[model samples]
Target: IARIAWLSMGLPLEVAATTVDSQCGSSQQATSLGAAMVASGMEDVVMCCGVEMMTRVPLGSNMKDGVPMGESYMQHYQPTSQFMGAAMIAEEYQITRADVDAFGLKSQQNAIRAWEENRFEREIVPIEAPVLDDKGQPTGETRVIARDEGLRATTLESLAKLEPVPGQSIHTAGTSSQVSDGASVVI
Candidate 1:
Protein backbone atom coordinates (compact mmCIF):
# COMPACT_ATOMS: atom_id res chain seq x y z
CA ILE A 1 0.00 0.00 0.00
CA ALA A 2 2.84 2.38 0.78
CA ARG A 3 4.54 1.79 -2.53
CA ILE A 4 1.24 2.10 -4.37
CA ALA A 5 0.33 5.31 -2.57
CA TRP A 6 3.80 6.73 -3.24
CA LEU A 7 3.47 6.06 -6.96
CA SER A 8 -0.08 7.44 -6.92
CA MET A 9 1.32 10.70 -5.56
CA GLY A 10 3.57 10.94 -8.65
CA LEU A 11 6.72 10.76 -6.59
CA PRO A 12 9.98 9.87 -8.34
CA LEU A 13 10.25 6.12 -8.80
CA GLU A 14 13.80 6.20 -7.46
CA VAL A 15 12.67 7.27 -3.96
CA ALA A 16 12.51 4.29 -1.62
CA ALA A 17 9.20 3.54 0.09
CA THR A 18 8.16 1.07 2.73
CA THR A 19 5.40 0.59 5.26
CA VAL A 20 6.02 0.48 8.99
CA ASP A 21 3.72 -1.00 11.60
CA SER A 22 3.98 -0.26 15.31
CA GLN A 23 0.44 -0.79 16.39
CA CYS A 24 -1.32 2.49 17.27
CA GLY A 25 1.86 4.59 17.15
CA SER A 26 2.72 3.59 13.61
CA SER A 27 2.82 7.15 12.28
CA GLN A 28 4.77 8.49 15.19
CA GLN A 29 7.13 5.57 14.89
CA ALA A 30 7.60 6.28 11.22
CA THR A 31 8.41 9.90 11.99
CA SER A 32 11.00 8.76 14.48
CA LEU A 33 12.55 6.35 11.99
CA GLY A 34 12.56 8.99 9.28
CA ALA A 35 14.26 11.46 11.58
CA ALA A 36 16.89 8.91 12.52
CA MET A 37 17.57 8.09 8.90
CA VAL A 38 18.07 11.75 8.00
CA ALA A 39 20.23 12.39 11.04
CA SER A 40 22.42 9.44 10.14
CA GLY A 41 22.86 10.81 6.59
CA MET A 42 21.00 7.87 5.12
CA GLU A 43 18.38 9.94 3.30
CA ASP A 44 17.88 13.60 2.46
CA VAL A 45 14.17 13.52 3.18
CA VAL A 46 11.56 11.05 4.36
CA MET A 47 7.82 11.08 4.16
CA CYS A 48 6.44 9.48 7.28
CA CYS A 49 2.92 8.29 6.73
CA GLY A 50 0.16 6.20 8.25
CA VAL A 51 -3.47 5.42 7.59
CA GLU A 52 -6.44 3.59 9.07
CA MET A 53 -9.68 2.87 7.25
CA MET A 54 -11.58 2.29 10.45
CA THR A 55 -15.00 2.45 8.79
CA ARG A 56 -14.04 -0.71 6.90
CA VAL A 57 -11.69 -2.55 9.28
CA PRO A 58 -12.69 -1.15 12.67
CA LEU A 59 -10.12 -1.17 15.53
CA GLY A 60 -8.50 -4.01 17.47
CA SER A 61 -9.69 -6.57 14.91
CA ASN A 62 -6.43 -7.00 12.98
CA MET A 63 -5.28 -9.81 15.23
CA LYS A 64 -8.59 -11.61 15.00
CA ASP A 65 -8.81 -10.92 11.25
CA GLY A 66 -5.45 -12.68 10.66
CA VAL A 67 -2.74 -10.09 11.17
CA PRO A 68 -0.35 -12.36 12.99
CA MET A 69 0.05 -12.13 16.78
CA GLY A 70 2.26 -14.95 17.97
CA GLU A 71 1.46 -17.14 20.99
CA SER A 72 3.69 -15.17 23.38
CA TYR A 73 1.81 -11.91 22.71
CA MET A 74 -1.48 -13.69 23.30
CA GLN A 75 -0.27 -15.08 26.64
CA HIS A 76 1.22 -11.84 27.98
CA TYR A 77 -1.01 -8.99 26.84
CA GLN A 78 -4.64 -8.43 26.06
CA PRO A 79 -5.88 -5.49 24.06
CA THR A 80 -7.37 -2.84 26.33
CA SER A 81 -9.30 -0.61 23.97
CA GLN A 82 -9.08 3.19 24.08
CA PHE A 83 -12.53 3.49 25.67
CA MET A 84 -11.60 1.03 28.38
CA GLY A 85 -8.32 2.86 28.95
CA ALA A 86 -10.18 6.16 29.26
CA ALA A 87 -12.51 4.63 31.84
CA MET A 88 -9.53 3.39 33.80
CA ILE A 89 -7.96 6.85 33.75
CA ALA A 90 -11.21 8.45 34.87
CA GLU A 91 -11.48 5.99 37.73
CA GLU A 92 -7.93 6.70 38.78
CA TYR A 93 -8.27 10.48 38.58
CA GLN A 94 -11.75 10.43 40.14
CA ILE A 95 -13.31 12.14 37.12
CA THR A 96 -17.08 11.92 37.23
CA ARG A 97 -19.57 11.27 34.46
CA ALA A 98 -20.76 14.85 34.79
CA ASP A 99 -17.26 16.19 34.21
CA VAL A 100 -16.71 13.97 31.19
CA ASP A 101 -20.05 15.00 29.71
CA ALA A 102 -19.24 18.68 30.21
CA PHE A 103 -15.91 18.26 28.40
CA GLY A 104 -17.60 16.41 25.53
CA LEU A 105 -20.21 19.14 25.18
CA LYS A 106 -17.51 21.83 25.12
CA SER A 107 -15.56 19.94 22.41
CA GLN A 108 -18.66 19.55 20.24
CA GLN A 109 -19.50 23.19 20.69
CA ASN A 110 -15.98 24.19 19.66
CA ALA A 111 -16.09 22.00 16.53
CA ILE A 112 -19.43 23.51 15.52
CA ARG A 113 -18.09 26.99 16.10
CA ALA A 114 -14.94 26.30 14.06
CA TRP A 115 -17.03 25.15 11.10
CA GLU A 116 -19.39 28.07 11.42
CA GLU A 117 -16.54 30.59 11.38
CA ASN A 118 -14.78 28.73 8.56
CA ARG A 119 -11.63 28.60 10.65
CA PHE A 120 -10.72 25.31 9.00
CA GLU A 121 -11.29 26.65 5.47
CA ARG A 122 -7.64 27.35 4.80
CA GLU A 123 -6.29 24.37 6.74
CA ILE A 124 -8.29 21.77 4.83
CA VAL A 125 -7.10 20.69 1.41
CA PRO A 126 -10.04 19.99 -0.87
CA ILE A 127 -10.00 16.74 -2.79
CA GLU A 128 -12.22 15.55 -5.59
CA ALA A 129 -14.33 12.60 -4.47
CA PRO A 130 -16.58 10.57 -6.72
CA VAL A 131 -20.31 10.90 -6.39
CA LEU A 132 -21.53 7.42 -5.73
CA ASP A 133 -24.93 5.96 -6.58
CA ASP A 134 -27.11 3.71 -4.43
CA LYS A 135 -25.04 0.69 -5.42
CA GLY A 136 -21.78 2.55 -4.58
CA GLN A 137 -20.67 2.98 -8.18
CA PRO A 138 -19.31 6.30 -9.36
CA THR A 139 -22.04 8.42 -10.99
CA GLY A 140 -19.71 10.28 -13.38
CA GLU A 141 -19.72 13.34 -11.16
CA THR A 142 -17.42 14.48 -8.37
CA ARG A 143 -17.59 16.65 -5.27
CA VAL A 144 -14.91 18.61 -3.46
CA ILE A 145 -14.66 17.48 0.16
CA ALA A 146 -12.89 20.13 2.23
CA ARG A 147 -14.07 19.83 5.80
CA ASP A 148 -14.22 17.46 8.72
CA GLU A 149 -17.23 15.12 8.59
CA GLY A 150 -17.09 13.82 12.20
CA LEU A 151 -18.05 17.04 13.98
CA ARG A 152 -21.39 16.99 15.76
CA ALA A 153 -23.64 19.52 17.44
CA THR A 154 -24.36 18.35 20.94
CA THR A 155 -25.62 19.97 24.13
CA LEU A 156 -25.16 19.13 27.78
CA GLU A 157 -28.67 17.78 27.97
CA SER A 158 -28.16 15.55 24.94
CA LEU A 159 -24.86 14.22 26.20
CA ALA A 160 -26.26 13.51 29.64
CA LYS A 161 -29.15 11.60 28.13
CA LEU A 162 -26.83 9.13 26.43
CA GLU A 163 -26.15 5.75 27.99
CA PRO A 164 -22.77 4.66 29.35
CA VAL A 165 -20.62 2.32 27.27
CA PRO A 166 -21.30 -1.38 27.74
CA GLY A 167 -19.04 -2.05 30.75
CA GLN A 168 -17.57 1.32 31.69
CA SER A 169 -19.62 3.95 33.53
CA ILE A 170 -17.19 6.87 33.52
CA HIS A 171 -17.40 7.66 29.80
CA THR A 172 -20.12 7.39 27.17
CA ALA A 173 -19.89 7.51 23.39
CA GLY A 174 -19.91 11.31 23.46
CA THR A 175 -17.02 11.54 25.91
CA SER A 176 -14.74 8.86 24.45
CA SER A 177 -12.61 9.02 21.34
CA GLN A 178 -14.09 7.84 18.05
CA VAL A 179 -12.68 5.81 15.17
CA SER A 180 -12.62 7.42 11.74
CA ASP A 181 -11.41 6.68 8.23
CA GLY A 182 -8.30 8.75 7.61
CA ALA A 183 -4.67 8.99 6.58
CA SER A 184 -1.86 11.22 7.82
CA VAL A 185 1.68 12.07 6.78
CA VAL A 186 4.59 14.01 8.23
CA ILE A 187 7.31 15.00 5.78
Candidate 2:
Protein backbone atom coordinates (compact mmCIF):
# COMPACT_ATOMS: atom_id res chain seq x y z
CA ILE A 1 0.00 0.00 0.00
CA ALA A 2 2.80 2.43 0.82
CA ARG A 3 4.47 1.70 -2.52
CA ILE A 4 1.19 2.00 -4.37
CA ALA A 5 0.40 5.30 -2.72
CA TRP A 6 3.86 6.63 -3.60
CA LEU A 7 3.56 5.52 -7.21
CA SER A 8 0.02 6.94 -7.49
CA MET A 9 1.31 10.30 -6.31
CA GLY A 10 4.06 10.21 -8.98
CA LEU A 11 6.82 10.23 -6.37
CA PRO A 12 10.31 9.06 -7.32
CA LEU A 13 10.25 5.32 -7.89
CA GLU A 14 13.74 4.88 -6.49
CA VAL A 15 12.68 6.17 -3.07
CA ALA A 16 12.09 3.43 -0.51
CA ALA A 17 8.48 2.86 0.42
CA THR A 18 7.26 0.53 3.10
CA THR A 19 4.25 -0.29 5.26
CA VAL A 20 4.23 -0.21 9.04
CA ASP A 21 1.84 -2.37 11.04
CA SER A 22 1.74 -1.68 14.75
CA GLN A 23 -1.99 -2.37 14.95
CA CYS A 24 -3.72 0.70 16.40
CA GLY A 25 -0.50 2.70 16.60
CA SER A 26 0.61 2.11 13.02
CA SER A 27 0.20 5.75 11.98
CA GLN A 28 2.10 7.09 14.94
CA GLN A 29 4.85 4.54 14.45
CA ALA A 30 5.17 5.43 10.78
CA THR A 31 5.28 9.13 11.54
CA SER A 32 7.91 8.66 14.22
CA LEU A 33 10.08 6.55 11.91
CA GLY A 34 9.81 9.13 9.15
CA ALA A 35 10.77 11.90 11.55
CA ALA A 36 13.68 9.90 12.90
CA MET A 37 15.08 9.31 9.42
CA VAL A 38 14.92 13.05 8.70
CA ALA A 39 16.47 13.95 12.06
CA SER A 40 19.28 11.45 11.63
CA GLY A 41 20.29 13.05 8.30
CA MET A 42 19.42 9.82 6.52
CA GLU A 43 16.68 11.53 4.50
CA ASP A 44 15.91 15.17 3.78
CA VAL A 45 12.17 14.57 3.59
CA VAL A 46 9.66 11.80 4.24
CA MET A 47 5.99 11.22 3.79
CA CYS A 48 4.15 9.05 6.29
CA CYS A 49 0.71 7.96 5.22
CA GLY A 50 -1.88 5.35 6.18
CA VAL A 51 -5.33 4.17 5.22
CA GLU A 52 -8.00 2.09 6.99
CA MET A 53 -11.29 1.26 5.34
CA MET A 54 -13.10 -0.30 8.28
CA THR A 55 -16.26 -0.79 6.23
CA ARG A 56 -14.37 -2.83 3.70
CA VAL A 57 -12.45 -4.75 6.35
CA PRO A 58 -14.02 -4.69 9.76
CA LEU A 59 -11.97 -4.65 12.95
CA GLY A 60 -10.77 -8.03 14.25
CA SER A 61 -11.44 -9.56 10.82
CA ASN A 62 -7.83 -10.63 10.43
CA MET A 63 -7.97 -12.62 13.63
CA LYS A 64 -10.52 -15.04 12.23
CA ASP A 65 -7.83 -17.31 10.82
CA GLY A 66 -6.26 -17.52 14.29
CA VAL A 67 -4.95 -14.80 16.59
CA PRO A 68 -4.75 -16.65 19.82
CA MET A 69 -4.34 -14.68 23.02
CA GLY A 70 -1.20 -15.91 24.72
CA GLU A 71 -1.25 -17.27 28.25
CA SER A 72 1.00 -14.40 29.30
CA TYR A 73 -1.65 -11.94 28.17
CA MET A 74 -4.44 -13.78 30.01
CA GLN A 75 -2.41 -13.60 33.23
CA HIS A 76 -2.89 -9.82 33.20
CA TYR A 77 -6.15 -9.26 31.29
CA GLN A 78 -9.43 -11.19 31.56
CA PRO A 79 -8.96 -12.73 28.07
CA THR A 80 -11.86 -10.62 26.84
CA SER A 81 -12.04 -7.92 24.17
CA GLN A 82 -10.40 -4.50 24.36
CA PHE A 83 -13.81 -3.06 25.28
CA MET A 84 -13.70 -5.17 28.41
CA GLY A 85 -10.20 -3.91 29.12
CA ALA A 86 -11.51 -0.37 28.86
CA ALA A 87 -14.26 -1.23 31.34
CA MET A 88 -11.72 -2.67 33.74
CA ILE A 89 -9.64 0.47 33.50
CA ALA A 90 -12.72 2.54 34.18
CA GLU A 91 -13.53 0.43 37.23
CA GLU A 92 -9.99 0.73 38.59
CA TYR A 93 -10.04 4.49 38.11
CA GLN A 94 -13.64 4.92 39.32
CA ILE A 95 -14.46 6.76 36.10
CA THR A 96 -18.24 6.81 36.02
CA ARG A 97 -20.33 6.49 32.88
CA ALA A 98 -21.60 10.00 33.54
CA ASP A 99 -18.06 11.26 33.52
CA VAL A 100 -17.44 9.57 30.19
CA ASP A 101 -20.62 11.04 28.77
CA ALA A 102 -19.70 14.53 29.92
CA PHE A 103 -16.31 14.22 28.24
CA GLY A 104 -17.83 12.87 25.02
CA LEU A 105 -20.45 15.61 24.98
CA LYS A 106 -17.79 18.28 25.43
CA SER A 107 -15.68 16.80 22.64
CA GLN A 108 -18.60 16.76 20.25
CA GLN A 109 -19.53 20.31 21.14
CA ASN A 110 -15.96 21.49 20.57
CA ALA A 111 -15.68 19.70 17.24
CA ILE A 112 -19.00 21.12 16.06
CA ARG A 113 -17.88 24.57 17.09
CA ALA A 114 -14.56 24.17 15.31
CA TRP A 115 -16.29 23.22 12.09
CA GLU A 116 -18.59 26.20 12.37
CA GLU A 117 -15.57 28.45 13.01
CA ASN A 118 -13.72 27.02 10.01
CA ARG A 119 -10.74 26.00 12.15
CA PHE A 120 -10.04 22.97 9.97
CA GLU A 121 -10.17 24.68 6.59
CA ARG A 122 -6.45 25.23 6.28
CA GLU A 123 -5.59 21.68 7.37
CA ILE A 124 -8.20 19.89 5.25
CA VAL A 125 -6.98 18.35 2.01
CA PRO A 126 -9.98 17.83 -0.20
CA ILE A 127 -10.20 14.38 -1.75
CA GLU A 128 -12.40 12.52 -4.19
CA ALA A 129 -13.74 9.60 -2.20
CA PRO A 130 -15.60 6.83 -3.94
CA VAL A 131 -19.33 6.43 -3.55
CA LEU A 132 -19.94 2.81 -2.65
CA ASP A 133 -23.05 0.91 -3.57
CA ASP A 134 -25.16 -1.22 -1.23
CA LYS A 135 -23.01 -4.21 -2.15
CA GLY A 136 -19.92 -2.15 -1.24
CA GLN A 137 -18.64 -1.81 -4.75
CA PRO A 138 -17.64 1.60 -6.09
CA THR A 139 -20.29 3.14 -8.37
CA GLY A 140 -17.69 4.34 -10.83
CA GLU A 141 -18.01 7.81 -9.32
CA THR A 142 -16.69 9.91 -6.44
CA ARG A 143 -17.70 12.54 -3.95
CA VAL A 144 -15.81 15.53 -2.61
CA ILE A 145 -14.79 14.99 1.01
CA ALA A 146 -13.63 18.38 2.25
CA ARG A 147 -14.51 18.21 5.93
CA ASP A 148 -14.76 15.91 8.89
CA GLU A 149 -17.95 13.90 8.45
CA GLY A 150 -17.60 12.15 11.81
CA LEU A 151 -18.87 14.95 13.98
CA ARG A 152 -22.24 14.39 15.60
CA ALA A 153 -24.56 16.61 17.54
CA THR A 154 -24.83 15.17 21.02
CA THR A 155 -25.91 16.28 24.47
CA LEU A 156 -24.88 14.95 27.83
CA GLU A 157 -28.32 13.42 28.28
CA SER A 158 -28.15 11.64 24.94
CA LEU A 159 -24.69 10.31 25.56
CA ALA A 160 -25.56 9.04 29.01
CA LYS A 161 -28.29 6.83 27.59
CA LEU A 162 -25.96 4.84 25.35
CA GLU A 163 -25.27 1.35 26.67
CA PRO A 164 -21.81 -0.06 26.96
CA VAL A 165 -20.83 -2.81 24.55
CA PRO A 166 -22.36 -6.11 25.76
CA GLY A 167 -20.53 -7.68 28.72
CA GLN A 168 -18.65 -4.43 29.41
CA SER A 169 -19.41 -2.07 32.28
CA ILE A 170 -18.58 1.12 30.38
CA HIS A 171 -17.39 2.45 27.01
CA THR A 172 -20.42 2.76 24.80
CA ALA A 173 -20.55 3.54 21.12
CA GLY A 174 -20.52 7.22 22.00
CA THR A 175 -17.55 6.88 24.33
CA SER A 176 -15.54 4.19 22.56
CA SER A 177 -13.44 4.06 19.44
CA GLN A 178 -15.52 5.04 16.42
CA VAL A 179 -15.24 3.38 13.03
CA SER A 180 -13.67 5.51 10.34
CA ASP A 181 -12.50 5.07 6.76
CA GLY A 182 -9.92 7.29 5.16
CA ALA A 183 -6.28 7.85 4.26
CA SER A 184 -4.01 10.61 5.43
CA VAL A 185 -0.51 11.72 4.47
CA VAL A 186 1.84 13.69 6.67
CA ILE A 187 5.03 15.30 5.45
Candidate 3:
Protein backbone atom coordinates (compact mmCIF):
# COMPACT_ATOMS: atom_id res chain seq x y z
CA ILE A 1 0.00 0.00 0.00
CA ALA A 2 2.82 2.44 0.78
CA ARG A 3 4.59 1.74 -2.50
CA ILE A 4 1.35 2.07 -4.42
CA ALA A 5 0.62 5.34 -2.66
CA TRP A 6 4.09 6.64 -3.54
CA LEU A 7 3.58 5.77 -7.22
CA SER A 8 0.15 7.31 -7.17
CA MET A 9 1.75 10.55 -6.02
CA GLY A 10 3.81 10.60 -9.29
CA LEU A 11 7.11 10.04 -7.53
CA PRO A 12 9.95 8.57 -9.57
CA LEU A 13 10.06 4.78 -9.61
CA GLU A 14 13.67 4.82 -8.39
CA VAL A 15 12.62 6.54 -5.18
CA ALA A 16 12.39 3.99 -2.38
CA ALA A 17 9.20 3.64 -0.43
CA THR A 18 8.18 1.31 2.37
CA THR A 19 5.67 1.07 5.17
CA VAL A 20 6.71 1.03 8.81
CA ASP A 21 4.25 -0.17 11.36
CA SER A 22 5.01 1.06 14.89
CA GLN A 23 1.42 0.90 15.96
CA CYS A 24 0.18 4.46 16.66
CA GLY A 25 3.68 5.86 16.10
CA SER A 26 3.93 4.78 12.45
CA SER A 27 3.93 8.29 11.00
CA GLN A 28 6.38 9.62 13.55
CA GLN A 29 8.70 6.68 12.80
CA ALA A 30 8.39 7.31 9.06
CA THR A 31 9.26 10.96 9.52
CA SER A 32 12.23 10.05 11.69
CA LEU A 33 13.47 7.59 9.07
CA GLY A 34 13.18 10.23 6.37
CA ALA A 35 15.12 12.70 8.48
CA ALA A 36 17.82 10.10 9.13
CA MET A 37 18.12 9.35 5.40
CA VAL A 38 18.64 13.01 4.65
CA ALA A 39 21.08 13.43 7.55
CA SER A 40 23.13 10.43 6.40
CA GLY A 41 23.31 11.87 2.83
CA MET A 42 21.52 8.80 1.45
CA GLU A 43 19.28 11.12 -0.57
CA ASP A 44 18.83 14.86 -1.16
CA VAL A 45 15.36 14.71 0.28
CA VAL A 46 12.98 11.97 1.38
CA MET A 47 9.27 11.74 1.90
CA CYS A 48 7.96 10.49 5.19
CA CYS A 49 4.45 9.15 5.08
CA GLY A 50 1.99 6.94 6.92
CA VAL A 51 -1.68 6.09 6.78
CA GLU A 52 -4.34 3.96 8.42
CA MET A 53 -7.64 3.03 6.83
CA MET A 54 -9.32 2.07 10.04
CA THR A 55 -12.62 1.73 8.22
CA ARG A 56 -11.22 -1.21 6.26
CA VAL A 57 -9.13 -2.70 9.06
CA PRO A 58 -10.16 -1.80 12.57
CA LEU A 59 -7.72 -1.36 15.44
CA GLY A 60 -6.44 -4.59 17.08
CA SER A 61 -7.00 -6.52 13.83
CA ASN A 62 -3.30 -7.41 13.82
CA MET A 63 -3.49 -8.72 17.38
CA LYS A 64 -5.53 -11.78 16.40
CA ASP A 65 -2.85 -14.09 17.86
CA GLY A 66 -2.37 -11.81 20.86
CA VAL A 67 0.62 -9.43 21.19
CA PRO A 68 3.24 -12.05 20.32
CA MET A 69 4.36 -12.89 23.84
CA GLY A 70 7.42 -15.14 24.04
CA GLU A 71 8.93 -17.09 26.93
CA SER A 72 11.71 -14.53 27.24
CA TYR A 73 9.25 -11.63 27.13
CA MET A 74 7.04 -13.26 29.74
CA GLN A 75 9.97 -13.81 32.09
CA HIS A 76 10.66 -10.07 32.21
CA TYR A 77 7.15 -8.74 31.63
CA GLN A 78 3.47 -9.36 31.70
CA PRO A 79 1.55 -8.90 28.46
CA THR A 80 0.48 -5.28 28.15
CA SER A 81 -3.19 -4.65 28.74
CA GLN A 82 -4.36 -1.55 26.89
CA PHE A 83 -7.06 -0.58 29.33
CA MET A 84 -5.19 -1.50 32.47
CA GLY A 85 -2.08 0.25 31.29
CA ALA A 86 -4.04 3.45 30.72
CA ALA A 87 -5.85 3.06 34.02
CA MET A 88 -2.62 2.52 35.91
CA ILE A 89 -0.99 5.50 34.27
CA ALA A 90 -3.96 7.65 35.16
CA GLU A 91 -3.92 6.43 38.71
CA GLU A 92 -0.20 6.97 39.15
CA TYR A 93 -0.47 10.45 37.73
CA GLN A 94 -3.43 11.29 39.98
CA ILE A 95 -5.67 12.12 37.05
CA THR A 96 -9.34 11.79 37.82
CA ARG A 97 -12.23 10.84 35.57
CA ALA A 98 -13.39 14.43 35.65
CA ASP A 99 -9.98 15.51 34.39
CA VAL A 100 -10.16 13.02 31.54
CA ASP A 101 -13.66 14.11 30.68
CA ALA A 102 -12.61 17.74 30.78
CA PHE A 103 -9.73 17.00 28.43
CA GLY A 104 -12.02 15.17 26.04
CA LEU A 105 -14.46 18.06 26.16
CA LYS A 106 -11.65 20.44 25.27
CA SER A 107 -10.61 18.26 22.35
CA GLN A 108 -14.13 18.17 20.96
CA GLN A 109 -14.56 21.88 21.37
CA ASN A 110 -11.19 22.70 19.83
CA ALA A 111 -11.80 20.55 16.77
CA ILE A 112 -15.10 22.25 16.04
CA ARG A 113 -13.54 25.65 16.59
CA ALA A 114 -10.64 24.88 14.30
CA TRP A 115 -13.01 23.86 11.53
CA GLU A 116 -15.08 26.99 11.96
CA GLU A 117 -11.97 29.17 11.84
CA ASN A 118 -10.60 27.37 8.75
CA ARG A 119 -7.45 26.43 10.66
CA PHE A 120 -7.43 22.98 9.07
CA GLU A 121 -7.65 24.47 5.57
CA ARG A 122 -3.92 25.19 5.63
CA GLU A 123 -3.03 21.50 5.90
CA ILE A 124 -5.92 19.49 4.49
CA VAL A 125 -5.59 18.19 0.97
CA PRO A 126 -8.93 18.05 -0.71
CA ILE A 127 -9.84 14.86 -2.55
CA GLU A 128 -12.36 14.35 -5.27
CA ALA A 129 -14.48 11.48 -4.04
CA PRO A 130 -17.03 9.78 -6.21
CA VAL A 131 -20.66 9.83 -5.19
CA LEU A 132 -21.93 6.29 -5.28
CA ASP A 133 -25.44 5.02 -5.73
CA ASP A 134 -27.09 2.43 -3.52
CA LYS A 135 -25.80 -0.50 -5.57
CA GLY A 136 -22.24 0.94 -5.23
CA GLN A 137 -21.74 2.17 -8.79
CA PRO A 138 -20.48 5.73 -9.19
CA THR A 139 -23.17 8.25 -10.04
CA GLY A 140 -20.74 10.40 -12.06
CA GLU A 141 -20.90 12.98 -9.34
CA THR A 142 -17.97 14.01 -7.20
CA ARG A 143 -17.49 15.87 -3.95
CA VAL A 144 -14.47 17.55 -2.47
CA ILE A 145 -13.60 16.29 0.98
CA ALA A 146 -11.25 18.61 2.83
CA ARG A 147 -11.83 17.99 6.52
CA ASP A 148 -11.78 15.17 9.03
CA GLU A 149 -15.07 13.35 9.47
CA GLY A 150 -14.45 12.25 13.03
CA LEU A 151 -15.05 15.43 15.04
CA ARG A 152 -18.26 15.53 17.02
CA ALA A 153 -19.92 18.11 19.23
CA THR A 154 -19.54 16.63 22.66
CA THR A 155 -20.20 17.90 26.16
CA LEU A 156 -18.81 16.89 29.53
CA GLU A 157 -22.16 15.52 30.51
CA SER A 158 -22.33 13.43 27.35
CA LEU A 159 -18.81 12.14 27.87
CA ALA A 160 -19.55 11.15 31.44
CA LYS A 161 -22.44 8.96 30.36
CA LEU A 162 -20.26 6.56 28.38
CA GLU A 163 -19.39 3.18 29.90
CA PRO A 164 -15.82 2.30 30.81
CA VAL A 165 -13.89 -0.55 29.18
CA PRO A 166 -15.08 -3.78 30.85
CA GLY A 167 -12.11 -4.61 33.06
CA GLN A 168 -10.38 -1.37 33.90
CA SER A 169 -10.70 2.31 34.66
CA ILE A 170 -11.73 5.68 33.31
CA HIS A 171 -11.52 5.49 29.51
CA THR A 172 -14.76 5.38 27.64
CA ALA A 173 -15.52 5.74 23.93
CA GLY A 174 -16.12 9.41 24.62
CA THR A 175 -12.85 10.08 26.41
CA SER A 176 -10.68 7.88 24.22
CA SER A 177 -9.57 8.70 20.70
CA GLN A 178 -11.65 8.06 17.64
CA VAL A 179 -10.97 5.43 14.98
CA SER A 180 -10.48 7.17 11.66
CA ASP A 181 -9.17 6.82 8.12
CA GLY A 182 -6.60 9.17 6.66
CA ALA A 183 -3.28 9.39 4.83
CA SER A 184 -0.55 11.91 5.57
CA VAL A 185 2.66 12.74 3.76
CA VAL A 186 5.65 14.89 4.58
CA ILE A 187 8.74 15.70 2.56
The most accurate candidate by TM-score is 2
Order of candidates by lDDT, top first?
A: 3, 2, 1
lDDT of 2 by residue, 4-50 (tens): 87899898999899999776677788999999999999999898987
Worst 10 residues of 2 by lDDT: 58-67
lDDT of 1 by residue, 92-152 (tens): 9999999999988888889899899999776567888888898658999999877777787
What C-alpha lDDT values do all the predictions have?
Answer: 0.80, 0.80, 0.82
Q: In order, how many clashes per candidate? A: 0, 0, 0
**Residue pairs that clash (backbone atoms under 3 angstroms), model 2:** none
Candidate 3 regions off by >4 Å?
8-10, 58-81, 128-144
Query: Which residue pairs does candidate 1 place in steric collision?
Result: none
Give the Å shift of residue 107 in candidate 3: 1.4
Ranking by TM-score: 2, 3, 1
Candidate 2 displacement at residue 105 in angstroms: 1.1
Off by over 4 Å in 2: 59-80, 139-141
User: Is 1 or 2 the stronger prediction by TM-score?
Assistant: 2
Cα misplacement distance, residue 63 of candidate 3 (Å): 9.5
Worst 10 residues of 1 by lDDT: 58-67
Stretches of model 1 off by over 4 angstroms after superposition:
22-24, 35-42, 59-72, 130-143
